[model samples]
Target: MIPQSALAIVALFASLVLLVMGNSSLGTIAALRLEIEGYEPGAIGIVLALTSLGFVLGSLFGIRIVQRVGHIRAFAVFAGIAAVAALSHPLHVSIPGWMLFRLVLGFCIAGLMLVTESWINSHATPQSRGSLLATYMVLFFLAASSGQFIVALGDPGMYGLFVIAAIFIILSLVPISLTRSTPPQMKRGKRLAFSVLWARSELGLGGAAVSGVVLGAFGIVGPVYGYEMGLTVEEIAVFMGISILAAMVVQWPMGYLSDYLPRRLVIVCVTGAAVGMALFTAAFGQRSSMHLYGGVALFYALAACIYPLSLALTHDMLAKHQIVPASSLLLLANGLGAVAGPAIGGAAITLLGPSGLFLFLAAALGLLLLLALHSFASERAPLVREQSHCVGIAPVSTAVIIDLDPRQESG
Candidate 1:
């Protein structure tokens, strides 16, 4: 039987899975709905970009919210706001109004993730935290991927899908809110500069930021891109799910490899593979439909590997207490890149066409590959420390990971 702490972790993740599913489904729905409503591509891009920005602010500020109200209260409040925001889509029809709701949704989702993760972190023994984190990564991808199918259940122009997203959030409130386990004692990290993080692990920081660029564009607008490419509704859904599932398959293996190999070497190989796949996807997209989907799946798989590898690499370098600060710094880098990626992709699509999305991906992956190569050239380590077991996590997680690091383990 699982311990109480382990049980709590399960309850939290179960709730989070639904929450993520609702949000991921909404991303696809929003893109389709905006297009159906006749919004410009640039305005659609701004909405997506604003959502990412809201998430950034929430991740930064969520610690205080948790620390102040405790996890259950925070979770309840955040989930409530998120649900209301989801339902707001049908209540009002203005693009600007929906933009406001998207920002609120992003902020609430970020807060909920931090609250839940902090609870998991506080409960987990270091011996188990690695697997726990990996479980989180797998569940979120699976949940998010499954959510894409919701599109087929109803047209985006209808109110049903929006209400369904709201329903998922409300359902998510059931698990952890009912749990008898204690909430984690949460706190903020000491701020660190980019220079400090780069010195700690150049490839980790750079790769995380680049991963954001690719993932942000893919998550926010990939469905729209697929539709513009003349894919059927069914094809668009499959393409998104296939890309997500492909990423899920490789996350653990890549994380395991990073445990033994030089972390930068793993980053280089993974990013390089993604770069090739992204370029192939762009070119093949014109000539063969089958090849385009295949290339997209593989490209996403390799690109998704970076988030975990980058986190593992960062863990390999930080002192026990410094983990939170490092995670925050790295999260910030990812957020900044995510904020930029969609606008850049939007511009590419505006200037070039739908295929421009793939070009943007390739260019981003190429930049990450270059960063890894530069790190390999520097050979700048002062001393190697004993490595911790690697943990896989999604990009949405915040800085509370310090508690899960084995180095910080205590009786």
Candidate 2:
């Protein structure tokens, strides 16, 4: 049986799963649709990159809306906006028009995530926070992975998929709107500057940026790559879905290994493995379906852990109070990298073809490996006498969710 605490927050989790499923389906559909529309890879890259820009802007400023209007109202507003944005894709087919809609969708989705995460954080006891966060991470990946299958529901070239996406977004409003619990008050906290965070742990910040670049680029362009490789819509869905599920499978084991070994050493090993997987995909991915799916899954499984491991590494060097604020700066660094990822990934695909995507990933992770090696050698000694245990966190999230981390003080 579920604990009362868990039972109490069922509405928030239900709402989150619905919102993410809709948004995730829309993201995959956008890439597939654009490919069918005859747009150049470079143009699609630019259009998709704008969504990251909007996400960064929303994470930074959307909190003000939450503060002013309260969580329940803010969620409704964001969800309403998101549903409309998803519907708008079917109505407007031009590049510029879709770009505008993508931006709006990104902004509103970030706001929706912000409200839900913050509400969950507020209600959590320190003892239960870790369990809750772990559950949240698992559900998040499941919803996102399952969402890929939603692409098979209708043809990308037609209006049916977009309508289905909008319906999912609109349906998300039902659970939260009907909940009886009072909303939690939003807390204002001091945020660390990037300069301060970098000075404290360059490897942590650098690793996050690199993780963002690799993950963000793949998220936007992987579907296009699959489509280019002559996969059907169902095949592409399985390819993307399995990759996300692989990340969820690998995170805990990787996090556990970091707890026993030197975190920096674990990071170096993971980065090295990621580089190898990226190269493997570049060389053999298009040769066969099994090779392609397996290589991509292994590559993503390694790449996804970097952000959370970086967070754990950074936490090792800071006081308890500093961890929350520092996380925001780390996220900002990641977001900036995400904003640039699509442009670079697209250009590579344009110049080198579908294989260019994996080649680029290999190069990026190789650089991060060098940085990790240097940091490990230079520091030599551990940053703290007792290193913090790693936690699984989604890289694309608002600062509010940082409060839910079990490492933070309950007060």
Candidate 3:
């Protein structure tokens, strides 16, 4: 048998590749529709929102695949669907067709991500889970960042990007599919116990939704916004790359701090700071390249911290049995936010110009921060308390704006 450590290394590697590629593809698509294909901004927002809807729908129920078909097989099935959808870019289908395909791709990507996470969770002991989680997070950040950069390499009209996406999907299959390690048989169960998860912990669910909304807005609509403002593809890619890198660099301190502090307090502070930053940019930032760099950096730092803090907050109250459900609920919430984010943010920009993008983001964060305060007020337990558990970094690796759904993984 292959050593479990070696299997972990392989699985993590594959998962990272998929995540980076999967995450990056949305930006490319949005940019292409706006810059290359000359799509209407309103239509693009709806299309992207539709994709988020697909993700939300898939995540809510896709767990059935693991129980019925096994993780490896289910992963392959979704990977194949995503690969096909991604590779079909050459057709440059009509707006309606693109939306339909995006919807399908959304589900496929969600399944791929969920199963990969579950597999990693299965292999890791609590002793090593933190490190494992950290490693996964780092790789996810790198992959997501690198994927955005890939858009800079060629014109969207070329099939190279699609081919690149296909290669990533295939590459993602290598590590886990080839592993000698076999996870424990999945417990056959309902696809998703939505009501159960919601009743258990709404906080984690909300965190996930916020995470989805924040990132989804930036991921799907940021490139499109940049394009409308006269940024070339390369510059647009750089904007995303730099912003994501900022998010990655900030994660260590943010993640570390999350373990010790009340997650709710940290969330309110970071998200509130993000809202302030967005408002500042709307009122004072320049539209020039130099300004874009600074704006993206600021946005990236504050926006990136929200989901992690939310995850930490929700994780605090969860019982052991609740972790998986809670995580799923978080993801689901994020997915819904992701779905709504681009539509609202994109529409804001479409109606009021690019400054509206920041305005939309600022308002959303501000609202969440306020709601968080209300939640704290109603709580029976102290908002800040001694942490009962140590989330020591596992030897591993590894949000949104309104995440109100009581589902999906927060991190």
Query: Candidate 2 residues 11-56, lDDT tens each?
Result: 8899888888888889889999999998877778788888888898
Tens-place lDDT digits, model 3, residues 1-411:
877766676765676577556547545644565447766666677787777787776665677776788878888898888888877656765777778878887777767766776666666654655566666666766677778877776777777777776777777887778776675454432234767655544555665677677777877888877787778878878787888778877777776676677666666777778888888777765556767678767886778777656655665666545554555456566667888888887888888887888888888777787777776667643345543332312111111111111222332
Model 1: runs farther than 4 Å from truth?
1-6, 381-389, 405-411
TM-score of 3: 0.85
lDDT of 1 by residue, 1-411 (tens): 778766777798899898888888888888888777877665677777778888988988877887788888888999999898988886787868987988898889899888877777777775886667667777888998998887777888889999887888888889988889977676555777789889888888987898888888888878778877887767777889888998888877887777777777878898888888888888887677689788989988888888778877787777766676777777788888888887788777767788888888898888888888988788653233355656666766666654555545632
Spell out the clash pairs found in candidate 1. none
What is the lDDT for 203 in model 3? 55
Candidates' lDDT values, in order? 0.80, 0.88, 0.67
Residue 205, candidate 1: alpha-carbon lDDT: 90
Alpha-carbon TM-score of each model against the true structure = 0.92, 0.97, 0.85
lDDT of 1: 0.80
Q: Top TM-score: which candidate number? A: 2
Best-to-worst TM-score order:
2, 1, 3
Candidate number of the best lDDT: 2
